[model samples]
Target: MFNDGSHGFSAQVSTSGFNRRRFLGGGAAAAAAAVVGPALLAACGSNAAPGSAPAAAPADDGAPATGILRVSNWPLYIADGFVAEFQKASGLTVDYREDYNDDEEWFSKTREPLSRHQSIGCDLVIPSETIAARLHRLGWLNDIRESRWPNKKNLQPGLLNANIDPGRKFTAPYMSGMVGIAYNRAATGRDITKIDDLWDPAFKGKVSMLSDVQDSLGMVMLSQGNSPETPTSETVQKAADVVREQQEAGQIRRFTGNDYASDLAAGNIAVAQAYSGDIVQLQKDNPDLEFIIPESGGTLTMQSMVIPYTAENQKAAEAWIDYVYDRPNYAKLVVFTRYIPVLTDMTDDLNKLDPSAAANPLINPPQSTLDRVKQWPALSDEQTKEFASTYAAITGG
Candidate 1:
């Protein structure tokens, strides 16, 4: 079930053994006990194989109301149990489906189809930078022009200038974060604060990666000196060496999906390679679980929503994309999903919704700290395959 890197670094993807049928059958009242914990259940939804989702339901009523807007995303991407409200406001029933567990799945389904400017069968989709750029190149995007969504101007400054969709022109930032450490301070009996910390011998068998190649190894490259902005294949190769060596030394305990939240909350791991937003929700119950942007440098990353060429409900899709940026609503999502708000106004909102933002370096990192972070370059198809293989070899997946 795992890809052993006999030839080169590879990725091993499999089921997490969490019961999805039981969760769905349990319904809302039993929702709190659904899976892992709030940190994960609220952040990651259940997974299924990649395939076409059912035809979107018709908008209610005889007259043509808003059409069903099919949106594909990682599990629990939208606010939990708020579909009814979204349907009411827009008159569009969201045929929301969770077919993708990670960006790689998104790329597999959307990259080629979108590159050819063909329909990928979703109205709204979220993708990491590499695929977002490819979508822009293929002209698969319908413009989220400033005239249409003025609130975009308020997105956080760091994301405002990302290279993948520079100026945020092609894709509106859905949620952006760095791949770094989420540690159990109480269990580790140490303050974890750097990318280099993942390699510490004392923490051997207590670490898990993102179950991704880029973010996993890209963070290592950032620590060694490289990013999408200054992509040096040589540096990347060296970074791969770090993973290979670390794995050989038994530093990595497992390669995990969002499931790490359960392990960290249960004190099964002292530290984990984590996304920024997920940790915010994790801290709600386990207040001591903290995230850090390693001093050795970490990747600056963003996920975005793009209106695809095949959208069935373009207007509804555009409306929903803009809704993700509304100050009050977005603040609520930040609390539920643990993603940092792109709007500057969110700082005050975070103070009110989750005051830890004032002291949480991961969400409100100082200007100087953000300056040190690097991002991975959008790869060409040949390069993506090569780099993916390089990363696979390192981790032995």
Candidate 2:
């Protein structure tokens, strides 16, 4: 079950070296299910070494069933046909809803629903990186059960070390990517490589940005040489100043929650601020839409597959989680979305799935560019609030 990688996805490195970083599952996790054993899942398969799905395993129903796993996400994040495939393969119906608008919206929903044990009414959900840390800290999520996810080993080290889910104990890496800008090459005669470019006269009333506090402000701070790792008091104030200025200058055409894509596509904005994955599909559909990182830096993030504490179908949910990372599936996703795959070894499988997709730099970047990107630190609640207020004033929102 995959959507060619969209919504929020990214990779992260850590103080520690590779190998210790943990990968909890591979695509088609059924292949790795045997290693995790039934304790982590329903335990209907024989324990062979690993690497193959159990034949006639209880998890593979291959027909639609009655129960549902309400999957919540940002609207139009994943490609079509995935829910159908997962339902067809596992025989479980999906009450898939696009309720996650932004970090704050999803965080609010989870806190209220999970606090009363109302389940957020969704068993599996995807949350952006910074919020993932918050969800894990708030104790609203489930713990990682390696046995339930036999394919965990295939995950890349960068994903393994994300502080958001530290060790990914509560969730699996859904998709890993960056947040940057997308523009129409024909409209913005200048190539956009720096943050100041968004304010260029050419993009006046033609630039768009995310409606979130973390990324919008974080990008501004990075452009000013600030690491989002822990925004100092002065740095925080400076970021707010930048947002206020941008809004006052009429530089931003509009701030968006999810409609950022539509605005960019309709030519409402010539240069668009966006997540690399979000604009990937738009680029394919509209050749004029091209994306670039700001000259200073970009905000790196990871969105993950988390099983809420109130999940009713943990067994089936675990089985399906594995399906997202299996080698073949992982390879398939890299092509459709054009976001770099966190798993390095996927080149072969990716080529097999689609040669042209593999060649797209947006899908698989050259090693040099990947090295320059960095993950922003999760700001404390105070920081988030301060930035949001500052940005609202700047964007006149």
TM-score of each: 0.70, 0.69
Each model's total of backbone clashes: 13, 26
Instruction: Name the Cα RMSD for model 2.
Output: 12.6
Q: How much RMSD separates candidate 1 from the native structure?
A: 11.8
Score candidate 1 by lDDT.
0.62
* Candidate 1 residue-wise lDDT, 1-397, digit = tens: 1222242211111121122111211221221121212123223331211221212223333333377888876555566556676787777788888764544335544545543445777888876555566556545566665545667867878777776567776688765566678999887888987778777888888888765666666677767656646665687688778777777888888776556877887787888987665665556567888888777766666667887766767667766776677776677666555554556657776778678654676666676766766766555544555665666565554
Q: For model 1, what is the error of residue 46's alpha carbon versus the real structure, in angstroms, after optimal superposition? A: 32
| Backbone collision tally, model 1 | 13
Candidate 1: worst-modelled 10 consecutive residues by lDDT: 9-18
Q: What is the Cα-based lDDT of residue 260 in candidate 1?
A: 80
